[model samples]
Target: MPYDLPDDLAKLSLLDIAEAVAARRLPPVDQWHPGEVIDSKMRISADGTWYHEGSPIRRSAMIRAFSSLLMHDAADSRYYLVTPQCRQHIDVEDAPFLAVQMEHKDSALAFRLNTDEFVIAGPENPLRAEGDPDCPAIYLAVRHGCEARLNRSTWLELAHWALDRSDDLSVTSMGAHFSLQPK
Candidate 1:
């Protein structure tokens, strides 16, 4: 079945958006514990491009399918395409995903990832800033210990939105306050 994303996010309330995000049927990658480990020869670049054996994977559907199986193992600090039988390691330059778009729905900030996945920023999925002060990178926590770096345009939009709410370079969503300043 095709994933149905809202045509107009602004028209949806925070509860509606939350329900939509929670309704996505994702694979149980977190529960999969495969003893076999091998290199998948796949790389997710900092720019959110997926490459296999040094060639870009241009198929969006393939990317989305693989992304659903992606998981990060905090014990080894590695990412893998996990299945019931094996785990294939993959290289990630920075973040595995990129936040290509953002919207302010009700009292929360909603983000659309490069793979066309939706994530809402809140206590469970917080927004953080890192890197140098001059060129800070904003990241939002995605599931399975993964994060998505906000693209330049999305970051700018978020900054503008935050500034409109306050002057301290901070934003509040779902009663949680987030500092956009680089740590």
Candidate 2:
């Protein structure tokens, strides 16, 4: 899906953004309890490109549909595309989604995923930094035990935004404080 980002995302109120997020309806993949699990022969590359068998899945609508059915099973440490009928395992190179864009407004940060989904960083969906301290990889909890890695540009944008907020390299959203420092 084509997403038209705001000319000035910072100008938008957090309430408006929250309302928009709430308005979106996603499938309940978590509630699906398929007895049979099978290989999907699909992979999501480190760059967030979806591939089936050996070829890339170019359809945005199809990717979007498949993504909505995505779930991470903690028991197996695996990702799957689930439905009421069956569960199909898929490989994720790094993360299921890539955070391509970010917006800071009202002390809250909103991220736009490669799949054109919006996620607000807060208590329910938190941000985490890992890997090297000098160039820490940042990620945001998406849903159903899945995460979205912040892309290079989005990370830089968030870093700049954080620098403007505090010297401690921390930011607060919905009364929860998040450290940008790598752990």
Candidate 3:
């Protein structure tokens, strides 16, 4: 079901947003009409730190709340904190979130995000790496165009699980083969 948000998102508190998400009342963010332009002071750094006006946002709850509203607008090639009635753009240096942990579950790999969301590595949510095995920018598609950059430890774990194929470093998840890197 669609959410009934305040006409002005600025008036909505973090708690409100969190509650809406927790209740699974998110509307299709891509379909939301943009209201008055609101410039966000927030920026997600390469290491998954959320900063507001150059200062790190230290509250974990606030970070999780904001993450619930994150959406990648393919049309604009930008990310936004989307609400039912209002939206605001945000900057993402690498990815909006981080995959901090991983679990090898039977035939699939389940990634746990910093937000505590679990994403199974499969055809719908693929794992990828940009660069060599030693120093790679690893990412896992968390949901709906939102990718989580795998933390260093998670990346290392993925590397250990990857199979060295004839011409690529690959892994099998849910019977689907994913290429990690060209050998």
Candidate 4:
């Protein structure tokens, strides 16, 4: 349960991000109370250290970044957290979802484009929005699965990444900040 952070992503606020996503993904879990719930497989330093097992937590971190958001959104709706296996992970039935999983050895979070507001998992994206360079970027390109860890930064990063690729980036960009509410 020990984890670390990558140099570039060592400075974000995971607690705030996780809180925001919890409110949306796991109402049952979120209702447990207000505190930190590190992913079962990962361990964060109480001393605020950003390093996992002496290595940087990048891919895993990305997963955590998105989970921070998706967990909150997973409530009420039917969505699947992509296992660190394939790209066919998400299963949205309504407007809510919460799923957390480990990053596969190959390092990938894959998802097919669907839904107006969607949570995507893939290796990475290579395309850009049609008009704006400031528009979000596509950093995901997995064929059918999402890889993730519970590192806080990863959850936030992926959410931001999704917003980047989003066609509605103009509208979503404003609400991209992490939130702390009830799931």
Name the candidate that leads on lDDT.
Answer: 1
- Which lDDT tens digits does candidate 1 get at residues 45-84? 9899999999999988899999999988999999999999
TM-score of 1: 0.94
Candidate 4 per-residue lDDT, tens place, 1-183, comes to: 543332121222344333332343321322333333333233223222223345444564444443433332234332233323211223322222122222211222322221111222321322122223443222222112221222234335554554665644321222232221112
In model 2, where do residues sit more than 4 Å from their true spots?
1-12
TM-score of every candidate: 0.94, 0.92, 0.78, 0.19
Would you list the clashing residue pairs of candidate 3? none
Question: lDDT of each prediction vs. the true structure?
Answer: 0.90, 0.88, 0.73, 0.29
Which candidate number has the best TM-score?
1
In order of listing, the candidates' clash counts read 0, 0, 0, 44
Per-model RMSD to reference:
1.5, 2.2, 9.3, 16.7
Candidate 2 displacement at residue 21 in angstroms: 1.4
Which TM-score value belongs to model 3? 0.78
Q: After superposition, how far is residue 75 of candidate 3 from its true place, in Å?
A: 2.1
Give the alpha carbon lDDT tens digit for every residue of 1-183 in model 2.
464543344555778778767877888888889899899999999999999997999988788889999999999899999999999999999999999988877768888888877789999999999998898899899999999999999999988888897898877877788898887
| Alpha carbon lDDT at 37, candidate 2 | 89
lDDT of 1 at 143: 94
Overall local distance difference test of candidate 4? 0.29
